[model samples]
Target: MNEELRHQAYAQLEADADRIVRLIKVQMDNLTMPQCPVYEEVLDTQMYGLSKEVNFAVRLGLVDAEDGRELLEKLEVEVSKVHDLYMQEEKLESKEI
Candidate 1:
């Protein structure tokens, strides 16, 4: 692949990862609680979709395997942080009540 194509692929992957993180943040902020089954379902769907996208890119040789792994890892960490924050807020609400 040309250098520009490789760069674009990587950038697109990064943007998708960022979009997932933002979605998690928004979901936590305004939608169901983290413990809700709906929340779990949404999270699972989003993660699975992103993984499929990464796999497709890897198979196409648009992105390196290691980079794809890293992208997923980083997104996982970010989503974890969002979940943690919601959990913490729940705890604080319970304590206040």
Candidate 2:
């Protein structure tokens, strides 16, 4: 792929990652429990879509497999952090009740 196309692919990947992170944050912030079924469904679908995008980039030679894996790992870490925060808040709320 040409440099421009490679750049575009990277940009799209970054956007996808940001979108997922934002949705997670919004759900966590607005919901009492972060484990809502609808939220889980949406998250799963978004994650699958992002994985497919990364796979396509790898297949097209726009990104390396290792790099794609790293990108996903970073997103996972962010999601985990948000989840932990949500759990902590839930614990605090329960204690207050």
Candidate 3:
């Protein structure tokens, strides 16, 4: 694989990951709670799309399999952190109410 192509693939994947994070953040801020069915559906769809992208890149020799897996793992951790924050806030609000 050409070095430039490899670099572009990796960059694009990272960018896609960032876009998903932003989307999740927007949903988290202005839409349904994390545990809502709609929220879960969106998250699942986005994650599945990203996983397919990663698999495609790996098959094309543009990205390593482990690297793609790690990317997904890191994104999951980030989403969890965001969800946890919202959960904690919900708890506090409930207590106040």
Candidate 4:
């Protein structure tokens, strides 16, 4: 793939990661314990896939390390944000009980 195409794919993958994080947060907010285990497994799988894609893209010269790092950093930020939001929601829910 061309550089532009590779970048676009990276963006899509990042979005997918963010979306998965959001879904996990939603599941957590509702106190869904059984689903949390499944979500954790899925998150691990997706993270591995994303890491492989980053390596492949860099190796193929579709993207440089700096570019890949930036994308990964963005993903990290999104994941952190979602986790924080979920924790806050959980705290609020607990207070209501």
Candidate 5:
């Protein structure tokens, strides 16, 4: 693949990951609902969309299943770091009292 196209692929994969995260949050929140007809449809659509993007990305060599897993791991690590930073800030602010 051309270098520019490879970069494009990376950007696309990143966007897809962001979208998947949002959809998952929606799914989780909806699980607490008593009865939500739209929940299932929304989840199903998001899932199918994610699968399609993954398939395309894999076929194009932008990301394999292992690569996807690695990306998710990195995402988790980043989120954890942010959470820890927030907690530390809260602690420091509390100490200022």
Candidate 6:
């Protein structure tokens, strides 16, 4: 792939990651427990979409397979942090009630 296409693919990948992270944060903010089934469904769908994009980028020579995996890994780490925050909020709310 040309440099421009490669740059575009990388930008898309980063944008997708940011979008999902923002979605997760919004869901957490709006939901009481952050354990809604619908939220999980949406998250799963978003994650799958991101994976497909990464695969396409790899096939197009826009990004290496290992780098794509690393990008996904970073997203997972962000998700884990959000989950931990949700759990902490739940615990604090429970203590008040």
The TM-score measured for candidate 5 stands at 0.48
lDDT winner: 3
Clashing pairs in 5: none
Ten-residue stretch with the least lDDT total in model 6: 31-40
For all candidates in order, the CA lDDT equals: 0.90, 0.87, 0.94, 0.71, 0.61, 0.89
For candidate 2, the lDDT comes to 0.87
How many clashes does each candidate structure show, in the order listed? 0, 0, 0, 0, 0, 0
Error of 3 at 19 (Å): 1.0
Q: How would you encode candidate 2's per-residue C-alpha lDDT over 1-97 as one tens digit per residue?
A: 6988888888889889999999988987876356689778877898899999999999999987888999898888888898898899889999999
lDDT by residue for model 5 over 1-97, one digit each (tens)?
6777766876777776677556545444445231356655664575566567767777877666776666656655654454455557657989999
Q: Could you list the CA RMSD of all candidates, in the order they appear?
A: 1.0, 1.6, 0.9, 3.0, 7.6, 1.4
Q: Per-residue lDDT tens digits of candidate 6, residues 1-97?
A: 5888888888889999999999998888886355678888888899999999999999979998998999999998998899899889889999999
Check candidate 2 and list the clashing pairs. Answer: none
Where model 3 places Cα greater than 4 Å from the true spot, the runs are none
Local accuracy of candidate 1 as per-residue lDDT tens digits, 43-84: 899889989999999999999999999999999988998888
- Judge candidate 6 against the unseen true structure and give its global Cα lDDT, from 0 to 1: 0.89
Q: Any idea what lDDT model 1 has?
A: 0.90
At residue 35, candidate 5 shows an lDDT of: 31
Tens digit of lDDT per residue, candidate 4, span 1-97?
Answer: 6767877866776776677667666666665642377767766676777778888878977767887788777776776777777677767989999
> TM-score: which is higher, 2 or 3?
3
lDDT of 5 at 39: 53
